[model samples]
Target: MKKHQPAYLKSHSDGTLAKKLAAANARLQHCDLCPRRCLVNRQAGEKGFCGAGADLKISSYNAHFGEEPPISGTHGSGTIFFTGCNLRCVFCQNYPISQLGHGQPFTVRELADIMLELKKRKCHNLNLVTGAIYLPQILSALELAIKEGFDLPLVYNCSGYESLDALELLDGIVDIYLPDAKYNDPRMSKKYSQSADYPEINKLALKEMYRQVGDLILDEEGLAVRGLIIRHLVLPENIAGSEQVLEFIAKEISAQTFLSLMAQYHPAHLASNFPELSRRLTKPEYERVVDKLHELELDNGWCQEL
Candidate 1:
């Protein structure tokens, strides 16, 4: 009602951002920032499972229109694609940027400049993609951006495997959450993403995210201001456990939870090597998930027309 303002403004004014930035930066020493718990001190130049160091590596930043309609809006979501991912999903489409680390290093000041620049382009929100590996740097840059009048909403677009501690730092700093419920089955997650703990971590992460921002809130123009937007990319043969994901959202989280049922699966990266993930999601596989969504009374959100 009172004209939605970005959460960081309050966090910054209350001095919460400073504290969160400090605590997050400290995690680089041991580097348990993600679910990986790769205790290799990233500040000491030790590369962990994510292949990220202290320096922030970003692939690109742009006003993207490829997100959900509410997120993209009339302008676009200011997307900052961070290079390197904590998980190694075999079918990753952005394999070059996420796995092979195709990006250039950026200072916190330069990163802050990018945020201001996006705001100048009238982007709806600052969308941070694959940000788990660079939480500290993002926070530091956000602090700088806030000082320079970056008033846009912040979207944490991440693979669902997250650390609760890392998320705690983002309590009031982030406004919208665009996270994936990538896999529901532990075996499938382990086989594809090499993270046996993805399901458990993703579930817990979603809970925290939902607690922070309850349901998706749209403005007068149907643009998202704050809230969680769950993305479940439909995988070939249901390897992504789509039914279980929808069930969890409907029963555990909320039936009204904003969902973006994705049908854009293609055998990229090392997916060709794995028989289970070697093909695009079939019409049947995607339809089944959509049917289940209706069955579960998930009336809110968008279903891709594939």
Candidate 2:
């Protein structure tokens, strides 16, 4: 929303961001950017399931403190909220932006300008939220931003249902992978998120994320400089039991994997139409998930104090 750059942004000496950005952009021709593989002619302004064409549709950009301690740090994580989402979770907290795709349409240049602006603000990282469909634009913007002088550890904030092919394109481009491990059960996915293959997709996608970023990298000040962080929001009625999710994370991925078990669930949008998830998560429900996670002995991450 505002233009600001930090002093460190001007002294960047990591590597050519344009190369990585090019690598990512090459994958967009067929547009297998996500598991959907919509393959629309994005270059010619063809809109896919995500609503927008090749142009970047951004809802909001700001410094956010609601993230994990490391990502948020003291200053805050510079967050760019991209409109439109691949997954349509019935209980989506940001329904207005995701479902509606309500935002300003920005070309790659304008998008890159936002990156430089964030750098000037002394933000911890460039956080891209719900950026699955706009990978091409993001890559182009990163390239432009690098040329104009902007550098910080990049954060790929996304839902876990991502294409391995798309993720492979982002091998070195993303420093921190913030993916939500939602819908452990396919039933909940089909009924709520509209993605019947959520479990399979999310599980496989998370493994790729772990393979790419591995464990989180913290700075000397204990802020996250790079790595993967998994977030799992506890839903009402234990339908998407957070316990099973924690167990799966411990068994499938590394036990040291960073996790955020959130308790901030409330019936939103069309959720009231459904009987089971018509209200907020109970305190006991949140505590039960926490207890199970502890019992599983997963050694890292935080569960918001319910």
Candidate 3:
């Protein structure tokens, strides 16, 4: 079997990647990168709702094996955890990195070097976590990496509250999109993540991602080459609206859509502030969502054991 060349390589060779990089950089002036539309001029050192500026701040990078099998493979995924996030989820597991912004800033060239280093370590793909805020910098780093023979598949690991414009810039550049379908209820979204428009925005983002990459495709070695993988964490008390999310994926997206039904929702961060979110996800709650997964015939991915 032929080794799968990532889509960004073609985009780079054909000049599409450069165009995207430039377009993404242009957004920094007004900064509508995510759904927040915080018109702050990040290039001029202003911080927005996500607390990110022009500088690229990264919490960590490593070969991670804890992701979905296709993404991690045997060598593990090259994971780059970016600091800060668009959504203020009260139960965010990585609050130190996402909320408190615990990370070191790096120049674009250094960021590119990190990608090269990850490839040298033989990771399956470059998995960028919470990167929507730093899209421009990531694109810049990717351009530099591509020139230096870095060809790992790019994974846009993100919260589903994405802007269509930002995703448009990434159309050809990102090979795999790993987005979370956090909630189907606006009330739940608002109460938990502090984003009232999350459900509506998330659905649109999922649809756009599906349109860009129809279904998950694995290589001969069973590693993902390209696709859209939607993850839904079964929150306690059905606050995540897991059943409705599954139905939408099966009906609106595709029955063939790959899913990661996450059953690891342990209350963290400020989850204790909300009585409904203070406990871990129960076995029954997770099993109910698993049953819905089977009932909807959306059986193309993994479900963790509760």
Q: How close is candidate 3 to the true structure, as a TM-score?
A: 0.98
List, residue by residue over 157-221, the lDDT tens digit for candidate 2. Answer: 99888988778767767888999988788888889988889889999988988888789877778
lDDT of each: 0.92, 0.82, 0.93
Ranking by TM-score: 3, 1, 2
Top lDDT model: 3
Model 3 lDDT per residue over 170-277, tens place: 898888999999999999899889899999999999999989987999998899999999998999999999999999999999999999988888889899988988
Off by over 4 Å in 3: none
Pick by TM-score: 1 or 2, better one = 1
**What digit string (tens of lDDT, one per residue) describes model 1 on residues 55-142?**
8999999999999999998899999999999988888889899999899999999999999999999999999998988988998899
In candidate 1, which residue pairs clash? Answer: none
TM-score of each: 0.98, 0.91, 0.98
Which is superior by lDDT, 1 or 3? 3
Worst 10 residues of 3 by lDDT: 280-289
